[model samples]
Target: MYQPLAYRLRPKTLEDIVGQEHLVGPGKIIRRMVEANLLSSMILYGPPGTGKTSIASAIAGSTSFAFRMLNAATDTKKDLQIVAEEAKMSGTVILLLDEVHRLDKTKQDFLLPHLENGRIILIGATTENPYISINPAIRSRTQIFEVHPLTPEAIEMALDRALTAKDGFKDEDVILEQSAKRELAFVTNGDLRSALNALELAVRSTPKNEDGTILITKEIIQECTQQKGFSHDKNGDAHYDVISAFQKSIRGSDADAALHYLARLIEAGDLISICRRLLVIGYEDIGLANPAAASRTLDAVLAAERLGLPEARIPLSVAVLDLCLSPKSNSAYQSLDRALQDVKNGKATTIPNHLKDSHYKGAAALGRGLTYQYPHEFSDGWVAQQYLPDPLAHTRYYEPKFTGRYEQALAKRYEELHQKKSSSTK
Candidate 1:
């Protein structure tokens, strides 16, 4: 069998693991569990290629326990029965179940008794959200640890280890340039497996020179992965991930990283998605920080749509950079959500009679707008009156976050306009 480079170069021990320090680092939960040889059933959850299976394999090797691998998708109850029988024959079993959330109710039910008796130590790996997809009974038996995505630096470290490992290309005279390494790391989007696979393809496919040294370049890496490390399906999980990263980078004020993902989206010919997501990031994430920025981003998005692909990126990038450098606040979205939640939970009450629509005929006859106070007649166009329903007359939802100059002014005005006696004095 031609094993992939990622599998061959998988981290064999807990110490060898590169990313996910929260779980595997010294004094961390998983590492401490391994050091004491006190293994328990664990369900590792995260995106693909984030080392969930690798960690399970590392635990089995370190503990000297008999390791068995199974896929929930293909394996049946009968296969699990065999594993259980093996656990009885042997001392203990470390079962690495990949895509474990797919295991049906019957298999999950069978797993509980074995887990309780400590006959089989289950190490399930899944890309889906385990809490939502996995059987609750299975979750109750296992410690759930979410594996975070590897950073570019972590991915690059894995690539380097593969290039020099004894089981890897250590014997081969491979010349990987620095630029190629960075590009590969950036393009993989924190997926170490993708990085190793791309490197393997690039190295094996490239022609050797007269000196028998295989040279790997930036172009070669791009050719293998396609479109300069922008291997994204517009409709896939990767597309959502990149868009999320892009928006978060901008919110974090990391202009360079934001621009990099923006470029990636453009390369994938996903201009419309980018434009739409940028609008959301501007208003939702960058809300109240610079209110003008949201409208400006909308204008920029319109321009990008009008200009189209090749040149559309120009305006889109401008908006991304602006949003990246701009201050960020989610107060608007959060406050609106608070109000929405209250309404959804039956907090919505009758509209104040004075504040009802009175422009229509006979609205006054119903005493709808009779007692309404005109704010313009009061000083500074500000009159303290009930605008919300009677049940929520004093409920304040939209509180301004003093982030940017614009929101700072809003904060002061909001405080003055709302602070008053228990009831409206008007």
Candidate 2:
């Protein structure tokens, strides 16, 4: 039977591991733990194709303890009890659980007693967030090590290793063109297993010419992995990428691209999440410039909530288009960011004494509200006064952007106030 290329090229040792040099390198955390045989319960958290299973296998093979494997997706509470009993009899059993987040609350809770007693050194592999899915007690007992997605360079290196390794492509003389390789990497999106599978499929499908050399082209690579792409799931890198693209499209004033990305998310059953995010972005990115953008987003979210899927898509499309076409300004967001930084860096100035309360007892005795002027009593219904503290009186935090209807009025009012203040001071 022919083994899959990914399985055939699986790394057998720490040195054979393709990526994650930060953990498995010489004198690293994993190396130190393995060397001292002081293994603790650990959670391997990362996306797919990052070698969580391979690392567990390497640890099991290298250690002297008996190794047992189970999948949380299928295992029961009784199954966990059996493993716990066996580990109690055995000196130290390394229990490797795959998809540990799939275990229900009861099944996950079953491992706690064993884990606390040190009966088994649990190594859990999960694609989901452990904090959210796993029990807090289980999480507290384990050392969480985050495994990152493979970089493009790492994927390329793995492909090269697979081509030349004794176990993989030994007899095949398949050479991937530079363009084909780049396309394959891009399609895989840092998934090592997917990259290898694509490479294997490309090599197997390509017809050799009379020259006896098979050329893998970009077209063939694209054909191997169907290019009918969809928006990302809510919990992974794709989620971040799609949202980033959506925001960038709006910021770049590409209404078409913004609409396209919105449609992609809506069609992928992410309408509710997309609506919520749009509402947030409308306020955060498009605040006050076109305040109506935020209202439109809220309407979209309400429409999605009330009507649900399929029918709610109309409002979602409208909201996305309105946000994209709305007058854009990030000045308020940037000003808040600067103000927050100043506060964080201990640059927050005190409130001016005139703005302090004089109605409270003994407040007027401390010169509070001594020279405060009421704007309503003035000729122009505006007063000239130091609103900010003495130290930051000249600090200009909010600079209005002249883009939308609201901002235009705000700019005029601000200019009039400054003119009145200048005349009063003179």
Candidate 3:
């Protein structure tokens, strides 16, 4: 059973690590802790394959501590007990708990004391934000450091290491062209594991010459990775970046760029994410200007969900196109934020007595709904009335954009009503 290239080529020492200079670099927090042998319980937070596990393994390598790993979901209390017993005699056990955020109550309670003291030096790795997912008690005890996506330069370094290292392809007699190498780095985005796997696929699948010299070109690399070769890392930065691009492109009304990003996500085959993002873009960016477009986008998303992949992309693309071509207006989004901000800042205003609910047992004796005119009784079905809080009575919140007919109509109606109210007051 051969290990995956990423696993086999994992850095044995902290120095061999590829990225995350903020943590692993000389004099950084991790390096300093390692140097002083004061390694404390900590959490390595980041996107997958950004070297969280590798860093944990490297810590054991560097410190000569007994290393043991267990999945938070599957490992039993008995298994943890075994590690604890081993640690008591072996000095300290470096425990690498994958998906530590998923740790159950039984195991969590058992590990608490061990983690608090020096018996079990815990290194938990999670792709999800620990602050949101992990137990607060456990979180408070450990130092948290974020592992960022590998830069292209760092990915290139990892590739070079894989090609030349003894544990990697050093003895394979393969010639990877510089252009091909760069393509692998670029296609993998910031995921070195993805690059290594693609490299492994290219090297193993492609034929060698009579002399056993394997020549890997950019075309061969592309073929191995299926050309698109992207590692979206679902919850990662790349995923967020694509979503951001899809939204901004549509908001800027650049149908071409928006479609390109749509194709990228479609190629990734994440219908759920694509569907969710499309709906958000429709409402947040194309609101007011094309309110109906948001509903249509929802319809398209439903269609895509039912149809699934390739076929689903059609409806998604339709929604994307409609949103891009529609008049763009973020005014509604801004207005809501402004009103919410005022509320958050403690700008208190009591609800007007006239507007208070009058349907309750309390009658006109308390003047709960006094002077509240019923607009429906008026011939025009309109009346000059104050519905806002007393302090906010004259504080206008909605500023409809004039880019579309619906909002422009709203603006006009609002202006007329305000003018009439003002004249009546005078």
- In order, candidate lDDTs are 0.88, 0.81, 0.88
lDDT of 3 by residue, 159-250 (tens): 88888988899999989999998898888767778889999999999899999999999999988877565545565446767888988899
Error at 335, model 2, angstroms: 16
Worst 10-residue lDDT window for candidate 1 reads: 417-426
The superposed Cα distance between candidate 1 and the true structure at residue 290, in angstroms, equals 5.8
TM-score of each: 0.69, 0.65, 0.77
What are the per-residue Cα lDDT tens digits for candidate 2 across 363-387? 9899899989998997877677888
Q: Which residue pairs collide in model 2, if any? A: none
Which portions of model 1 miss their true places by more than 4 Å? 1-22, 45-50, 104-106, 128-137, 146-241, 252-257, 268-273, 285-293, 302-310, 322-335, 341-395, 400-426
Using lDDT as the measure, name the better of candidate 1 and candidate 2: 1
Q: Which stretches of candidate 3 lie over 4 Å from their true place?
A: 1-8, 149-153, 169-172, 179-190, 194-228, 231-245, 252-257, 295-312, 325-327, 330-370, 376-381, 389-395, 399-409
Candidate 1 lDDT score at position 175: 88
Residue 6 Cα positional deviation in candidate 2, in Å, after optimal superposition: 1.2
